[model samples]
Target chain A: MSLLKEFKVLAFLVVLVTGAVLVYAIGDFPDWGDPISPASEHVSSYYIENAIHDTAVPNIVTALLADYRGFDTMFETVVVFVAGIAVLFMLRRPKRESEVSMDVSGSPIVKTATRIMVPMMQLFALYIVAHGHHSPGGGFQGGVILGASLILMAIAFGLPSALKKISNKATVMLSALGVLIFSGIGILCMFLGGNFLDYSVLSAILPGTDRVMARSHAMLGVEIGVALTVMTAMFSIYADLASEGQLDQGL
Target chain B: MIWQFDIIILTLVIVSALSALRIRDLLGSAIIFGVYSFLMCLLWAGMGAVDVAFTEATVGAGISTVLILATVLHTKRRTKD
Candidate 1:
């Protein structure tokens, strides 16, 4: 047998065994939403009970993510930023002379529709970020939607036009700025006599609000940072990948 | 979660996932992967994890699919054994 065929056979056997083991493991999992499950019986209960009072955010998930676990979120943003930079480093290349020319315009119907939808999509993304403390959507989801809108614009009106709007330089800078914003907030909290990412201490510097409100405000700021990083990172990956790192063509 | 809806979505998720792996056309596989993502999103939503559902929808179903399709277009459309 060929080497490739042998390799495929081995891979398939491994996959089949792994799948069977996983299926067997699934039978031992706790029933759906079992309150006594280890996951629901410990820190989760504490978060659900006190998240709102502690962070003044109605969305417990947001509070848990942005305030209680701000350190993790900050690193997550950094990871996204790094991923964007990695793609740029690996794939980006100067435009080729022969590859410069292509059809740049799309059907008017699609262009017009995208034109109308893009702004609305952006606005909704903002809403998702801003209202995340009260709702289901948050920085990550909003950022992806925003990035998808940009990708859609690229698809409809062509890459060059989209690049004109959000240039590679801007994407890189914006993504870095996002990580900066996140860490910057943490640093500010430390400067205010608290641990890193401890927003309760921020109340000492702000004019009127108490510690709870401070945490709520800080969560929003962190969410914005996350949104910015995620959106730019998503767009950068797409632009780089779609254009084969040339940033001068579209598929 | 409703058992009926859960079972239906879980079935579709498995079907799409298996087909996505089996499909020889790279673009078709990518699109089927998106379908798998969407179904997973539905399952998350049904389980009341709206934030996860939203992320799965936007990142998994939307962006990853388009990215894969773009890559497929630039490369080979069909997989060779």
Candidate 2:
């Protein structure tokens, strides 16, 4: 059978099975917005009520990302760093006297669309990161958006051009800086009289009502670090793949 | 309405996983696996586990798929039976 025919069959099968399963599973699922699941009972409720007062951010997701479950965020940052290193190690090539550059020219419409969308996407990412304490989005979602914008750049102008704009060295450095900055905040907290990552200790250094603001500011700082590292790591991986012409080469 | 979404997502997950296994082409399998991850994300969201869903969408659907596709590109497109 031709590949097109095979794909059609696969699509039909997927739809049929999916429809059947949906009918079965819908009967068993909990009501949305119940506020009684493990999420509400275990950790989310606490974050919802106190996070704003404690962290001074309205976004529960942001509080979770930076404070309530910050240890996970730290490890996640490490994971991204490891991934970036792994990709670099796998794809690094010796510079030739003359390396071939791929043609990156695109139609006027595509170029204009990318140019308009890139900054808008980036701003949206920042908004998500900043408002995470009050809304559905946080560092991870925002970071992914940022990475996707970079991927869009690669798609529009080609890999080499994207790489030229955000070099591998720069991305690696940004990843390291993110980790270092995060750990540094913890260390600073330790110095001020709390355990590893106690944001409350930061209050002592500030005056009057500024203490609450200080803690929130500190959390935002760490969230930014997480976002930066994750975004760059993702972009680095895409760069590795594109450099190898992996998607197009069909191996 | 929410339960309906959950069921839809769960069904999507199962279908994608099964199709991924059945596909003859390695690239197609990788793409299906990505779709599976995405469905899993929706399932998590429907269950009100937004954080888990967010992580799954990013790591599972986004990065993992890209990595697998990259590996496939560097290797074979079909598995020998």
Candidate 3:
């Protein structure tokens, strides 16, 4: 047998053995529906119990994500921002004549469909971002949808057309603005005599708002920031990757 | 975790993942990967992780597939091997 075939055979055997071992190991895990599973018995119960009271948000996931774990989400947003900048820095190059594509825009039907649905898609994404406190969607998910709408625009109408709507400079600035909004909230909370990202103190800035209400409002702002960062970052990455740094004549 | 729904989606996810790995056409592989992502999204939602399922559907199925298709456009469609 050839070397490649031998390698594939060996890899297959290794995968089979690993799968068997993993399946066997599943026996050690807590029961599928057990309420007493270690995960549910600990910090999760605390979060579930206090989530609404603490953040005034009906969605426990959003409360935990943007309130109890705001610091972690802040850094995650920074990571995404950095990724966008990194892609731009690495992939951006001058377009060459030889690299010009056969043109993007798949067909007339696809283009017309995109033109019709892109607005609705973007509106839905915005709703997802804004309604995260009461719904299953959040910053990352909504931002991705928003970015995907832009990508769909790019794919259906060409990169240059999409770029006209959200140019490179605008993308970079918006990403930075998103990170700024996140950290700015944290710093303001600190200035108001609370711990970093302790949004309870935000009540001081907004008259007649209680701590819980303030926290909810702050969480919305934070989620919006995350959504902005993620949306711009994902779009930038797509632009660089699809255009191969030249940012023109892409599919 | 409803075993009924989970089991159905689980099989589809496995099938799509395997096919994605074995497919020769790069674009076909990307499409199969998107199918795998959608199946996994259903699995996640069935398991009561709606946010995760949404993320998987949007980022995994939607965005990742688009990027892969774009990459395939820029690169070779057929694998040499």
TM-score of chain A, cand. 1: 0.94
Query: Distance from true position, residue A57, model 2, in Å?
Result: 3.3
Tell me the TM-score of each prediction against the true structure: 0.96, 0.77, 0.95
Once fitted onto the true fold, the runs of candidate 2 whose alpha carbons sit more than 4 angstroms away are A1-49, A96-99, A104-109, A205-211, A245-251
Chain B TM-scores across candidates: 0.96, 0.91, 0.92
lDDT, candidate 1, A114-225, per-residue tens: 9999999999999999999999888898998999999999999889999899988998899999899999999998888899999999999878989999999999998999
Compared with the true structure, model 1 gives a TM-score of 0.96
lDDT of 1 by residue, B1-81 (tens): 888998888899889988998889998999999999999999899989998898899889998899888889989898984
DockQ of each: 0.86, 0.33, 0.85
lDDT of 3 at B7: 76
Model 1 chain A lowest lDDT segment of ten: A97-106
lDDT (C-alpha) at residue B62 in model 3: 90
Report the lDDT tens digits of candidate 2 across residue range A105-191.
567898799999999989998987887766677777788889988887776787667777887679889978888888888888899
**TM-score of decoy 2:** 0.77
What would the per-residue lDDT of candidate 3 be over residues B1-81, giving only the tens digit for each residue? 767877788888788888888889999999999989998888888878898899899989998898788789888899976
Residues forming the 10-long window of minimal summed lDDT in candidate 2 chain A:
A242-251
Q: What TM-scores does chain A show, candidate by candidate in order? A: 0.94, 0.77, 0.93
The alpha-carbon deviation from the true structure for residue B8 of candidate 3, after best TM-score superposition, in angstroms, is: 1.8
Q: lDDT of each prediction vs. the true structure?
A: 0.91, 0.77, 0.91
